[model samples]
Target: MSSSMSVNPLWLFKVFPFLRWWPMVNGTATRADLLAGLTGAIIVLPQGVAFATIAGLPPEYGLYTAMVPAIIAALFGSSWHLVSGPTTAISIVVFGALSPFAEPGSAHYITLALTLTLLTGLFQFTMGIARLGTVVNFISHTVVIGFTAGAAILIASSQIKNFFGLSLPRGATFAQTMWAFFQQFDHINLHVMSVGLVTLLTGILVKRYTPRIPYMIAAMLVGSIYALILNQSLGDAVTGIRLLGALPSHLPPLSLPELDPHALSQIAPSALAVAMLGLTEAVSIARAVAVRAEQRIDGNQEFVGQGLSNMVGSFFSAYASSGSFNRSGLNYEAGARTPLAAVFASLFLGIILLLVAPLAAYLPIASMAAILFLVAYGLIDFHHIFAIIKASKRETAVLLVTFFSTLLVELEFAIYLGVLLSLIFYLMRTSRPNVISVVPDPRASHRPLVHAPDLPYCPQVQMLRIDGSLFFGAVNHVEQRLLELEQEHPQQKIIIINGRSINFLDIAGGEALVQEAKRRRRQGGDLYLYGIKPAVMEILQRGGFLEEIGPDHVFETRDEVIRHVFSVLDRDICMGCQQRIFHECKALPSPGGKPS
Candidate 1:
């Protein structure tokens, strides 16, 4: 049998499906993976419901998402510990896209959400197959930081409506919500506030004091009990604390994603937006965790993993899904050994959620809101933001611009703007390559470097050093500097450039270098370059510059070229020289001006 078949009969599918992860499992790995999976399953139960509600889906849909998508992504993905599920960013994006079509929580809206998921997954999968993952190179760290911080703020702002039982209008902007929340302060429901505050405190205390407890689970439990007490003390009608009621206690039922071409055409733009936004979040989080773990990321492969997860998830009662920062981090911290842990986390989460659906009827919606508030707060990297404000001016500007843009403009457009700004700044830096005029230091020196600015030149030769790449972007600046050097020192015919450090040279740059050499030669002075590295010399040779400049003119040593060039200078013209720049000039026969 072939090696491919010997490894596994499903190797053909493993190459593309990525779902072979669970089947490839063994004994020792399963032990570590189960431990990690159980830990994650314990944490995600409350978070799944909260995130689903945030996405404007029926609460059960959140648990539905945690099951299938997580399994698919983990099995197919490259990360050992990354857990894929419903996330805050994906929820906000879905709400923004669907609310325009039908009012949130309506049947029409749910259908549209599934349609959007299908389109997004299709696009991501296409991109993965086409190997276009390198496109993410445009997204800088500043853009991510700013966008995440803004998303964090949006999360906290959105939950205020539920947490305080405020009747603020739906679809209000972040700023408007803040204003409305404060304005409606007198109408706050005391019972709701008590449950929410207790839930928030419980989450904090469990995370800080117990540390190992599933704080989210504990907080929700405590909040549910507190709400039950109040309902008993004061009749449910008077206290007015709403419950999540009963959630469907069953496996995720398969459904068809809307595929009408007319429906696809109408929501095509939103699909594109969701695809970009969802893929960006997933890839970014994966890479961030991978960097800490020192693992290589194949962007195209990850695209396939996430795309398949969402595409399959849509049919299995999931809205759009991506990498969840909290769950992925917890998976890593919990000592997950392989992607099997993720698969196990998803499966066990579904089973546990189904068995415990009845208890959800007692869980107060305000408690979920409070838990999400804590989750949102954790997303902001305040220390990093402060450090950025105190450090680089450019990075700080990028951060603020991205942050404000995310809040003010459409989310997809904001990400594009931030990436565009980063590219522009990067181009600006590379466009002006350093063009420096360096002179040899005859003074006391431990190493060879031209540092003294006041040293006199040989009057017939000019030394130049280029400190950056000679790419097409730097062509205009480099050409201008070269022309200026010739114009300023017309009589200094012999030029020797120190090109030892430059490693890359394109055809344009090589042709330009040769053209400059000929320009100097036409003016009755030759061009010589000292310490030309082998790589650069190869480029010059390949580009036909060596033939034009002459092989003898290019020397490995500076002293050799200087010695040869000095002998060619007119002893009679140099005889009456006042400025004896070279030490060699002083050894020459008389009429010389200045010390050599």
Candidate 2:
């Protein structure tokens, strides 16, 4: 018996896959993950506040997202390196969807946000239960690469108002935001710009020279010190710089979503949109990290985890949360070995909030914006972007389309557009399977078969290879090419199909094969298949295609098939053919019983 068949099933572990990593948790790994967690927690401090501000909620609501949702997502998700919490995209979406219905930062707005989160979670969880994990497969790698790059630009653009201390209109598009900035350039506050530049420079230096320390902490400290010195020298009234003010020092409090039918109906479309965006962001980030970590991610399990996180988070004051590229990348780069780092980061954040909530009053908004600029810059994977450009033209098209759509269109529509384009390109490639003509190379020791287009063969035989699935979509293509072969080259009636690459065969493909066999038999030859896959063979047998073509027409070995066909060829036709393509052609009996 094969070892694969002898292996016992780990059903319990599959249901709770985290058990595989739990046993490896020693003190060394714990300490490493804790350090990574500490770094991640520090970074999220400014991000949580920034994202909440984007969502038009009080900063504490963003902190609440980091607490419970981060913990729950880490524990239940399949990726060890994925960290889920408040994200800029989700926050922007929430604000856009709910701001018109209720005033920003109002009690009514918070209620609607929570209700939307609940509905989004319910939709995501239901999708996961239905085993719709393959949905993300349509979102190609190129699409993700392009989307993240576009999102990075959006992040930087969104912070331009704060970074330069411009009072632009809220919720402006990228173009409008830039136009507003240029129009208000003369009104830029020199003092606020100085603070932001100092923070940005400090972060760049630290990250370049001494990367062991968290750059955000160093940048914020330097910016805060500069603000204090400026305030002392020029007077607080003169500097005109604003602070983030103090944050709530307590943990997330229990809350409830408004369950009114009117409220649910109003937010239903937005909820569906948010659910898809959140799941896509989370799964895309997970797969990205998993690639770096050389780990496997179960997208379905991640969906269940994210769904449960948001559902539970709605009651804990979190608006909407998803996988954060900044935090997850930091977690992996900081030596985190498992999901415990995310859990620790959530817990450490709660404790850190108690001590540092007062210090937030001294942190300037310009400094926060500068740190976010750094985060946004980091998200654009330039290496992969360049590689994709140089690799395939189709992938490059997907990347460019996805990138532009993300910047120019609605966020949900951008995602859908990328996935739709990817599927269309994939179908276009698969619908026309590669049908190549091949010949045996007499000089080669291994891989003896080589493609030889326009090469001459035996007068009575034609050898070809099918290098894709034989499904309904591809049946017509294969049949049309085979029909052209018999119509154009009447002498080459015997067709041998090398089916080594055929992985799938449907009813339509089976019927096409039977039809081709019958046509060949009427021409004093027949269709033969070699190296057919078990699945295709089973389909042919079930459809009675094998009986019609005759079981003897199938060959297990290429050599046997070629030799058998050579011996049965008409001796009169063999005498005129000078090209002996197959070795068996040499052994054909001459008209007088001498070797041909």
Candidate 3:
């Protein structure tokens, strides 16, 4: 790391982007980073093995992911405290994507997993180079909530057989899994169920009451102790408990993915899903950590860093990797002063694995299942789920659709479906930009504007405000609404638009405004605008729309426009009005054109 940092700043920034934090490193920062790194290493030990199980990879591969990718992402990525590695979400996604292509845990499966990693890295790097980090924005928060909830169910279901010692078929659908559990209830293995129950109960208690201790480690310890006692009392043959076995102790070895055309074609769709999901997870974690660290993250740079990490990681036996939310948050809370903390964590993890590999032989499979159940449960954001359900009907629809699709459809496509539905709803809302009718607050001292549906408006003019952007996609809606306004009240030729809320305008919107002005002029009246933002004004001026609408027709405030427009209405018509809504109308003669 020091050797790499000794180069030119510009060159280092290009090659090792995290070197920017190099200058800030000193005795104090190094001590802090080492402490944070040690804390992270301790937390990831059990999590790595669990995540690898989720991905159907060898347990050691999870550690490899934590090591190589963590180091590379820290050195080349944007965020100071974001720790990249194997995550539950990414692991499950990898499993769901590639399980159809090859047998999970087989040599062929490992090869295909490497290939997918390479492709995902390539796609991510290209997107970064293209500066397309904003693509994640289209995937709404509701989509994430729905997909996670769905995935949580999938995770829990996948572990049910292991947790309960049931003989369910592998890779069964959610319904089949549940059905199998119920059918096998009478044949349940009490020993296995007891171990899982103890593990789950221990994890829940430790997490709730003593969060400082790594819950996975604490739970695994208790479950392993219980299993040892059971095995001692009743022989292993009678207990029928299984172990994770000793994990690989050596460093990650060199490997190559099968690059044949058939392999690429087989994995293409899955690779795309992995790439997009990895990016979304990584970027979201980075941004979330950045807020607490009071730092900024470069999404494109983070993309490139994650890409390079996975691309490089594939050759070193690491599967797809992304930012780990738990580890990153722990890094921040553990006093990480720089990205070096993540680097130190990778180094410490490698060292710890060498010492801890043999101890895994005593770890029971039921314990792992129990830990996963907890992880899956944690993924479901119940607070946000209830909030969405209570606050918005449309968002709730997105959440339900995404949640169900995740359970019913392919995991990858479920994400896409949620995003598609979200976009559809968004377009539907934006295309029909809210055209609100506003009136002066008669009860207010300064005549502020408010939406009062029952208020009596002047018969000759209508006051309206568009509360969204007027781009090509929305022009037709705005135009149609304006047309409807004219049709509804033919005598109200003047339309005063309160443009304060309109932040965007395109050529189509400009043309629509010009057409409205022209239509009003044809009827011996004209359109008036008030409180136009500078950006909208620029669009109007640049498109030669201000001339069409006439500069005198625009006003800086609603009150100014209303005052001037009141003077222009036919005096004879005003004389006959029974309801005098505006203060200007009070000065008019009673039932005649003469002044009062």
Candidate 4:
């Protein structure tokens, strides 16, 4: 083979990720993908329009978003089943961020949205290149559950005016919306409410009974048909039922976001919020589906894929997009074999758009609101929410704080707050490592160290096992505990630390240990360590802490520790003590030069 062929393919895979799965695209796989793509295309028709309504964008923009972004993400991302497009969380966030700056659905609003999408893409791409994918892990799963549930309520509340046919102000707060809703209770349009109720009920029944059918599409069709009947009987003038005018039946046209300094600066903050949320949604959905598809997901690759999709999508008049859990789940269940399924779905969506765009003229705003209500309801993960509440008070607090913050504060700020609280909680736990007193289990064959408070301890020596990293944050707590132990039992001057569980030891920890060793030596006893990991040993050695603590004091085995300490222990105390916790007591001699 040539030297060129002998070269590693890893670099090539980084540049062109689809190459990894291209060889698997056989006739069988293509056929499966085609079917899955068709199913996904059909499903996104109603969802694209509904999600667009939620985002305060023109309905066709939603369909356009699904096309270009989906194709780009599928080609570059590592997951075989993940389908990227507009999602509820991203949509609602876009609306929340931009609505204050410009009127929703206006030319100015669209321009701002495009700029936001471009900025978000840049953030994601930069993070991916910098290999900051692990940063998302800091945003706890509890935070997501809370944020999602809160966003769901926002979605439902946003549609109250349309759902009930009341004239509520745009950008109303949840409380204001509800208050206005009840105030205008007498003026509710019966015809619009009837259409929304019909759609909602139809969706509920169809989803419950007919699992195979796309319930949104079914509900949309039923709702549209029912609205037509009502309008014909009562006439449009009397019914007050509004229709979404016909959409343009064409491809996503070339467009440019305003790149002025003012526009960029204005949108930067919201763009970051969108970028983080989008990446979280995409990477999470990718990993979730990858588990079922038995594929390994590269989170950085996913970030890069999502970044490129939005960056390119911005030029094609597409709004910000991310991984759609519903569409991705459906794609996997429909037997999608490769990323080609997602590519096909996007292509089919474009084709489907050309055919169905004009049909949207008949789509009632009330019915769209009803569809969004269902979308909102679906976003709440009741199982995880209940589990978090039942399992842990700490997690429950995080969840509730995030959930309430999402409603009361700026949507993006809520995410930041949740992440901050999660980090604080994590730091609180790690900063206080478990400094447990342990004894050798007599019943176990290997006599492993166990935390048995009932076991009698030696008076001359104390043994402690630290169960967490000894970093800067935790060194103080560990040092304080050691100081307390010395104060409580001054006679037990010699100390042994089981360092096996200490995965990390920083400069501060090493310095603390050196001080501890010096203090112990002044009291006529020395600090010793056993089961110290090689990495930790290297740190201690590099810092000259091992010299201060005495190189001979560190042992590798429990037996070695016992024998060395027994030889140096106060044999006079052992002569009278009844507690012979260690088996070494059986053979060792007392201070009088006789076996006790």
Name the best candidate (by lDDT).
4
Residue-level lDDT of model 4, residues 451-567, one tens digit each, is 887777788888899999998999989999998878877888898899999999999999998898888999899888999999999999998888888899899977898889989
Instruction: Supply candidate 1's per-residue lDDT for 172.
Output: 77
Question: Could you tell me which residue pairs clash in candidate 3?
Answer: none
Candidate 2, residue 281: lDDT: 89
Q: lDDT of model 1 at residue 45?
A: 86
RMSD values for the candidates in order, in angstroms, are: 4.2, 4.2, 3.8, 1.7
Model 3: how far is 61 from its true place, Å? 1.0
**Candidate 2, residues 1-596: lDDT per residue as tens digits?**
99976745476554666776898689999999999999999889878887787778888888899989998888777889999999877886787678779888899999999999999889887877787877767668787778768877877888887888789987677788888999999988889889999999999999999987778889989999999899889987877788888898999999999999999998888888788778888998899989999998888888888888999999999988999987999999999988999999999999999988988889888888898788778878899999989998888999999889878876656767887899999988897898776777756764367786555566788888998998899998988877776676688888899999999999888888888888788868888899998888999899898999889999988988987887788778887667777886777666456777
| Model 3 C-alpha lDDT per residue in residues 324-344, reported as the tens digit of each score | 988999999999999999999
Q: In order, what lDDT does every prediction score?
A: 0.81, 0.85, 0.88, 0.91
**Can you tell me which runs of candidate 1 are displaced by over 4 Å?**
1-25, 265-270, 291-294, 439-460, 480-596
In model 1, what is the error at residue 40, expressed in angstroms? Answer: 1.1
Q: How accurate is candidate 4 locally (lDDT)?
A: 0.91
List candidate 4 segments past 4 Å from native: 1-7, 589-596
